[model samples]
Target chain A: MAKGFVAITAERCKGCGFCVEFCPTRVLALSSAFNSKGYHPPHIVSAEKCSGCDLCGMYCPDFAIFGGRYAR
Target chain B: MNEATLEIPYEIPEGARNPVEPFLRMDRMPHIWCAGCGIGTTVNCFTRALLDSKANLDKVAIVSGIGCTGRVAGYARLDSFHTTHGRAIPFATGLKLANPELQVVVYSGDGDLFAIGGNHFIHAARRNMDLKVICVNNMIYAMTGGQTAPTTPATAITATSPYGVSEPTFNLVALAEAAGASYVARWTTYHVKQLARSMEEVLKKKGFCFIEVISPCPTLYQRRNKMGDGLDAMKDYKAKSKVRNGAPTGECTLSKTGEIVVGKFVDRERPDYLELLKAQMIESLGDRYVEPEEACCSEC
Candidate 1:
């Protein structure tokens, strides 16, 4: 398993793309699919590379995306 | 190229909840902030700060004035008061005075704090009230359809200032420092880590603490100014920002397009309002000055 993972609630996303743009590992990208808000929520591009820093969470203005690491 | 857009098929941990959910009123989710609004980003930083500090939830009171940022009180799960426009500081002052146990926080926008409630802010800071203030500066009055605000940089076109503002912008950090704030710092929404750290620091700090967050108003400010979107604004901040911790507050003036100075400008010790009041009473009244707690209860 990857050291960490990110969970995305697509419906809550407004698609400002802060998470995808600022993700340190470049682990995410805007998906082609649209959410209920008609915005493209981010999808994991490199799941194993996620550092679970939650920088994505801090930058997510919509409160749509957050990351966490499994307990050691 | 096809793989770039493809989502990695992975299962989210069972029962995992977003970290921001607990700090916020989730039923009020899908908040009114427009896509790319940095107010929510500031809220995220605040929640993290609250959690990291492990403050008693019941003792924290979130007070907000009228504006988009004012809605923060409604969305937060803490003791909240959405006061009239520009009155958040006065209301917070009352809360702190009536019940000094509560950690009173005034969360409002630049227009609300610096423009509408500018006088109240200066006096509160002068008294060194035990209040933690978070000012989200989007540079314009966003909710009122983008009117130019006191902090709006020169040459920014807004609904009220089509030809660009002629008046000089207020240096918020300088004002706070001059007005006697015990702690003052400024950060952009893009500087999430630093912002959260400062918020955490303020939670434990006494006297008046102020943090000014320069946020992106993508819907109005950005769109009107021809800045592509909220993401573009973040990229702009990344390219321009300089972290000069403890830089003289007067030199930290924000411009429309210039190097952004951000960091802790002032962190010093000062006696707060309550302490001064207690000292004065003790000196003047001596035995006649009854302690607030020792005063007879209403039931008596």
Candidate 2:
């Protein structure tokens, strides 16, 4: 089970890939799927790798992705 | 592709709002920024800073001058004013004088703040006005088709400077310190945590506080210079940045593809304009001086 998860507002994403490129744990990647505006948003790659540091949240210029650690 | 049709690979819970949602005007969803613009990221740090500072939303006012970053005032969910081009500092000064209780923040782009409103910025800092100035220095003027701004690094090709800019660039950190700011710091978008922390510190402290945020303009600056996208610029920032606290402000030089010195360069306490005025009045006027009553209007 993953220790943390990222919640993405796919519709708000502009596909800049900042979150995917900067995620310390390499948990996300730009998905082939496109949003309504035709930009490729990111998707989870290895759920367990997510540390929920929210560095993705800080790097995301579009304010689309944010991470959180699950309560123990 | 509708949101429902395109399934994001992650299992997202329904009705989950991004923590930044409340601070932003959600109705203005889909902001006007480009795919890799960094202004919104700065806004995220700012909102986080505000949260950490525990500032009263009602008493915090955001002022902006015309430019891409200037749009922050409109998007922020607070008492915000979108002023004329290059006039954000003057407007903020007036706002601060009118209501001393309000924590006034002047947020604008490099062109708006340094190029046109240059004098206003220096004067405000000289007076040690209690204002928070956040300059998002993207180097080029992104909104105006990437024109060469005052802070644009040398040899960088901009819209207006087709032959490559030959003129020297402005040292924003040095300028802020020389202008008499009580606190000065420089950070790039990649250093979001430090940037947010510095911003929070500025809010808690008084007097003129300036934070220069070097952000990426991928659509224009990066693409024109063949520097790839926003992520590439961020990677460069991450690899080359050196954080030296208390480093002399005059030595912080920003060159194209060179090591960037980032950290708090100056922090000193100086009487703000309001404080100086009060002290002078009490000394000179003696018994004749009467304290100005607080805001009469309850809704101020």
Candidate 3:
């Protein structure tokens, strides 16, 4: 099985939670720490479970988060 | 202090660059769209379509009118024109005529395209001009506040229509077909793959190609109408939409709470405006007519 990773731009996230809500594998969660924009960006809660589908990226209006796969 | 007690920090991997970044103006990052607005999703699909189509980016031009979706032209890292309200179609028509090699696309919202620009829309399709038009229908006028628009579904409450809109809405697919657009399709932001595919098809096709993207406006339209939020609208689209390719345009009418018919309705070959113009000129003017190439730089 291929592993995946997720990354988010802190300031770009508006805390709409679209990425977190739309993640198919439940790999992401909103961080308690707030960005400069006073919004809680998504954080990788389960990196090993990410499939890198990038649907989160597709649905994110802010262009804040992206997902990618890694070679074993 | 214990020697092994130091906490080794977990190194964060480098963030993956957004695939659509190349097509977007990064300096204009953090687009002004409200959180949960579907315009951004449409933009994502559009940029992906452009990349998938492998179009000559330099030869592509985007034109838009005054509205939220009209802002799309400004964010695209291409030759773009933000024209006056209801003038994007004619402006793009002039651009296509001046240089037939250029692929001109007009991106605008419902009110901008279907209201004030409604006449231009029909005539452009009537002439069969080679223009790709993407009309994002959020149902209401979102930019100037949630007001009743020509595409607004009947009985929807808007700022201007507090008691519910009593007028019937224009069926865009029917109108486009009736006016003679060579290609016509409809999709929602939820149907990103289909929308992108349609965009690619229209890019490669000639004549007036129109795509109506049903997007959500969470800020005004959704909030006023109590339509949940952007995600809810996507869920609604997923539940209500029925994809039936080649369905008659007359059967694609949208209702307040009925099934949404979506798909590519029309695709046919037609002699576009420029081709007809050249043929007419050749027959009428005979030897007196100078080809554009021959007329080029004649004064110099």
Q: Comparing to the true complex, what docking class would candidate 3 get?
A: acceptable
Give per-residue CA lDDT, model 1, range A1-72, as digits (tens).
577789887888889999999999999999988776678889887888988888899899999999988767
Ranking of predictions according to lDDT:
1, 2, 3
Q: Encode model 1's per-residue lDDT on B1-300: one tens digit a residue.
A: 233354456777788788889989888887999998899999999999999999998999999999999999999999999999999999999888888988999999999999989999999999999999999999999999999999999999999999988899999999999999999999999999999999999999999999999999988898878988888999999999999999999999999999999999999999999999999999999989976663346898
TM-score of 1: 0.96
Clashing pairs in model 2, backbone N/Cα/C closer than 3 A: none
TM-score of each: 0.96, 0.95, 0.91
The interface RMSD for candidate 2 is 2.4
> Which tens-of-lDDT digit does each residue in B1-300 have in candidate 3?
121221112233555478788888999887888877888888888887898999999999999999999999999999999999999999999898878889999999989998999999999999999999999999989999899999999999999999999999999999999999999999988888799899999999999999999998888888877888887888889899999999999999998779999999999999999888889998999888875553245477
- Candidate of highest DockQ: 1
Winner on lDDT between 1 and 3 is 1
- Give the poorly placed runs of model 3, Cα more than 4 Å off: A31-33, B1-16, B293-300
Off by over 4 Å in 2: B1-15, B298-300
lDDT string for model 3 (A24-56, tens) is: 899878777777776677777776778877788
> Residue B8 CA error for candidate 1 (Å)?
5.5
Among residues 3 or more apart in sequence or in different chains, the pairs in candidate 1 whose N, CA or C atoms overlap within 3 Å are none
